[model samples]
Target: MQIKRNTALMVGVLLILAVAAWAVTRPAKPRLAAPTAIPVRVVSVAQQDVPRFISGIGSVLSLHSVVIRPQIDGILTQLLVKEGQSVKAGDLLATIDDRSIRASLDQARAQLGESQAQLQVALVNLKRYKALSIDDGVSKQTYDQQQALVNQLKATAQGNQAAIDAAQVQLSYTQIRSPVSGRVGIRNVDEGNFLRMSDTQGLFTVTQLDPIAVEFSLPQQMLPTLQGLIAAPTRATVDAYLGADTDNQTGDLLGEGHLSLIDNQISSTTGTLRAKAEFSNPAHKLWPGQLVTIKVQTALDKNALVVPPTVVQRGLDSHFVYRVSADKVEVVPVQVAYQNSDINIIKGVQAGDVLVSDGQSRLKAGAQVEVLKEPPQVIHTANAQVQP
Candidate 1:
């Protein structure tokens, strides 16, 4: 039994030794394949003149707006202008019932005529009295009494003439005329409606459409910059957009104008300053009380280095961009001088340097990159040009 045990142990040891020798002699596993190059889009840096603008919300206003009101209390007999009709200053807008005014004027004229007839008689009597007093044909007391009576009649004639003048002046107010040149708004009173001079709501409104104005507010910190523009020889230009979107990529432009005025005091609660601009609105596109976006060009930077806004990346400590060179990308730090919705003005990168615009997540320092070329745009041509 002992001899059999020793033989079995020797066989087991030899089998283990053979297995270890095979494991040591085997070939090593193949190395992992290298990572594929990341696909990216790149754009070359560009240098150009950039404009710096201050943006704010603005409201459209009319340069001349007036509420048409009746000067005298009377029934509105006729409306000469329809709603939304353009009219010039002093144009007939509406007519009030003038029959009552005309009658009052006639009465005043009749009173003046009666007074003049009496004054004529008084003049003749005064001449007779003077002759009698000179010749002593009558008593001095009687002549003096006649003279005083003539003077009283003359004063009554003057008072009647003054009443006639006042009546004529009031008659002129019966015709309602436009106070300014503008388009008419909705009517507050219709024909046959009695209007009063003290009515809070006027008959209608007229607002000047051409050469309109826009009011806007900006932060007080920008006051110095705005003052500089105002002090310049040429007036600074202002642009108004339709919507509140200040982003140039999406906002629609309404019109352009020149800076007109600035409020003397700033609002303490909001820390903002108010300003106004005047625009020639021949098309009447801008309306009163319309909210819009305004851009005021305050300064211009000559020969600024610009890049696509997407190329810039924010980091923990600073901003960065992946600069492409020789099919490799390197993380380059950049200082952003100014930025708009579309592009950014940078100072760290030089002009003509290529930058990666997309696919930045898989990038590392000195990482290999595959630049993607954009598909060519298809253009349509006229048949005549194509034939040639």
Candidate 2:
């Protein structure tokens, strides 16, 4: 019994020693620190042609407009043109009853014919009188009187011819014709209505619709830039847009044309300058008094440094962006050249700098960052890793 007890004690002591050795000499397990994932979004920077532009609201107008009226006092016998019909220059638009004027012209012509015949007879008599005077057969007073009668008859014939010409002109005035090539508006007078040359009101209106003009105003600050653009030898083009509202901006391409006119004085109320641009309007999609938005390319900077607009951020007094440097965020201030939709043309952002597109809002001056081995497709948080 004593030997067994001593053997049992020895085994227990050996097991205890083994436990003590494990407690003293076993390799220490490492303590792991939790990882921090910052939420963010990212987009790669690319080089593209950035256009400089000026945007403004404008209204369309007709370059030429005129009121059509009658030139003779007569009844409206026939209407030759319909409302909204396109007419060419000298096209017959309306006709009036010309019976009185025509009868008067016929009477004058008849009188001219009679006067010419009388003048011929007087000339023959004067010739005979001259022959008689040379032979001393007729008295000098009788020859002189015959010559004076011939002169008087010739003058009367000329005056009658003049009256016939004037009467014919008056008869021609009964037909009203289009003075310009344009679209006709509503007709104010119908057939059988008496019209007079002295009528102060117009019978109809015609507007030259094709090749329309779009009038727009630009801020006074844009004058310098516009002058510089105009000074260049090459002519610049402008585009016009029309839509239901400002949001649903639809651009109807009124074909490109030259800048026709610029107002001499600036508007004091709006602090803007008025300008006019002409369009080809081949399809006639543009009309008079149509509202539109104007976009003009002012200039192009060939050497401008540019980046995505999403990377730009506002600083206290200027704009800045966060760039990746040695696995850390570096905020840099940038002077912007201009913004074209999704891209921004800048002066300070370099070509090779890795810009933090989404995490810029959360980044401090220097924050440690790790580029994920597999970039996330969707980043919801502010400090998440952003993919380039």
- Which one wins on lDDT? 1
Question: On residues 1-388, what C-alpha lDDT tens digit does candidate 1 reach at each position?
Answer: 9999999999999999999999999999999999788999888788777676778899999999999888899999999999999999999998888898889889988988988898788778778878888889878898788788778887887888888888888888888898889999998888999899999899899999998999999988888888888889999988888874665525667888989898999999999999999998988888999988888877777777877778899999999999998989999999988775567778788888989888998898899999999952221111001000
Models 1 onward score TM values of 0.82, 0.76
Q: State in Å the error of residue 34, model 2.
A: 5.9
Estimate the lDDT of model 2: 0.75
lDDT of each: 0.84, 0.75
Candidate 2 residue runs with Cα over 4 Å from true position: 1-37, 128-151, 221-233, 244-255, 267-271, 308-310, 316-318, 340-343, 370-388
Error of 1 at 328 (Å): 2.8
Angstrom error at residue 385, model 1: 39
RMSD of each: 6.8, 10.0
After superposition, candidate 1 runs with Cα above 4 Å error: 1-5, 8-36, 114-158, 375-388
What is candidate 2's TM-score against the reference?
A: 0.76
